[model samples]
Target: LFLGLIILIAVWKLSQTFTIMNLGKETSESLGISYSLLEKLALFLVALTTSVTMITVGALPFLGVIVPNLVRKRYGDNLSQTKLMVALVGANLVLACDILSRVLIRPYELSVSLLLGIIGSLVFILLLWRGGQKDAV
Candidate 1:
């Protein structure tokens, strides 16, 4: 199915792209990877997958930021681990939100975008707060 294909491609490409990106720019360049091209390619792939996902499922903005950061904070900064973490966390978070949407109003369902926006913003704020606290120490 189109959804499965996009999810697979997104995970694979995300891992490869972020691995290269996290390696500082000078290091990536020295290793013969064109930073700009790879960055552009990664962005394109992400955008394509995101658009497809939105079309099929529904829009859930900030899932990307929320999932990746939650995973990394709990599991550490291993790139390979982070990729899998992103996929798993993103899927689970969506599932949870969908369930909440359906159950919270028995006769009607809440739009996923609304729930994700609220939850994602809170999580992002908490993450920022934690980071700021660490820096202030």
Candidate 2:
């Protein structure tokens, strides 16, 4: 519920803010966007999104950082599209990891978080090693 609202804000109210910020601090500020306020709002929205998600669905390690990078890597930095894509991709990635967890141990099933932690860590390391990211995580 709250996550959905924040997602909507990210997709709607804050999309222009993100686009402006993407232009870098000086340019965004010159354009009359209050960087600090928007930054605080973005951070608060992210915190609420994270808290709501963690409280409801439990944690999926590194999905926070990983999904956005993957989306941006493919779609560029359109935060509206990237925000929606991140939600969809995160859901799909979790489902895929859940399936893998159920199958990997045959008669046993691993918790999704554990599999996510392992997989997320490896992918993050790989991304860091690849190292051509124009955006800072």
Candidates' TM-scores? 0.82, 0.85
Q: Write the per-residue lDDT of candidate 2 for residues 24-91, one digit (tens) a residue.
A: 87898999998888888888877777787878889889988788888888898878667678879988
lDDT of each: 0.80, 0.82
Q: Which pairs of residues collide in model 2? A: none
Model 2 spans with C-alpha error above 4 angstroms: 2-7, 132-137
In candidate 1, which residue ranges exceed 4 Å CA deviation? 1-7, 10-14, 135-137
Q: Clashing residue pairs, candidate 1?
A: none
Report the C-alpha displacement of residue 104, candidate 2, in angstroms.
1.6
lDDT of 1 by residue, 13-127 (tens): 6676578677878988987888888788777777877778778777787898888878877887767767776887888898898899999988999988899899999998898
